[model samples]
Target: MNERIEDKVHFTQYISVPSPTSSGRSAAWLAKNWHLLNHLVELEATTLSVSARIEESIRGRMLNVVVHLCNVEDDTDFTELVLLSLSSELVKIQSISADYIEREVRCNLRGRRVTSDENDEILKEIMDALEKRGVRIDYS
Candidate 1:
């Protein structure tokens, strides 16, 4: 009997969070004048742009997002925005963890551990969407 050696490679994916052209502008406006628009700003507006990475494995990918927020009193609004944006990514979420780092908040959203077969199909779709949205991604 012969054992097959695992062909392993570490894929480090990088995504940049720029102020979204159309949506960013709207969000910014709301953030600045949230006090005026009583019903406009749903959340407290703690965050704006988010930077994340996808570490791919034989099973599934892990997503780590660094959430950035404007200096405000609370983060309820910002967190909602972050989650909404991420939900559009179509990454099967497994777990979510968050913490504060000085002025920025780091929210690590890990994807459901999947097998290589599932990954091969969903990986490109998610990557393409991110790329199309101007979220620069680099895999190595």
Candidate 2:
């Protein structure tokens, strides 16, 4: 028996920001920064997700920003954008990292078996750059 397999790779980065007191301010801030983020990343199409939630601690509300990139080559540009955007005092950035990998596999028996490896070197370089900028990466 033989099997054929296909693999695909994807990278995702998450940013957690503390929301301001007023909802209006939060909305305005996200809108403005989202535009700036798109400009900085310079991607043909932006893949950014923004959500807000209320926190029980002194930090009233929090915004969770998720950026998904289909190409590993864009890792450096995305990380640099995160660094630039988070430098603002209005938002408190909790963490930023290339912490997620999505794999798509297709297989068929009676074909051929195959294996593949990810771009670990590029990912490692991105992680190292983020660490140097004081961003702790979560490998989950």
Question: lDDT of each model, Cα atoms only?
Answer: 0.35, 0.35
Model 1 pairs in collision: 43-77, 44-77, 47-69, 59-114
Q: For model 1, how does the per-residue alpha-carbon lDDT over 2-113 read when each residue is reduced to its tens digit?
A: 2222212332322223355669766876577556444322222222332333333334343333233222444353431122233324344322221221112212223422
TM-scores, all models, native as reference: 0.21, 0.24
- Candidate 1: stretches off by over 4 Å: 1-113
For residues 1-140, what per-residue lDDT tens digits would candidate 2 score against the true structure?
22222223233334334356678876876776696455434433333221212112234342222222233345343321111123322234555433331121111111311222223332444455445545555665
Q: Where does the lowest 10-residue lDDT sum fall in candidate 2?
A: 101-110
Number of backbone collisions per candidate = 4, 2
Best prediction by TM-score: 2
Q: Give the lDDT of residue 97 in candidate 1.
A: 21
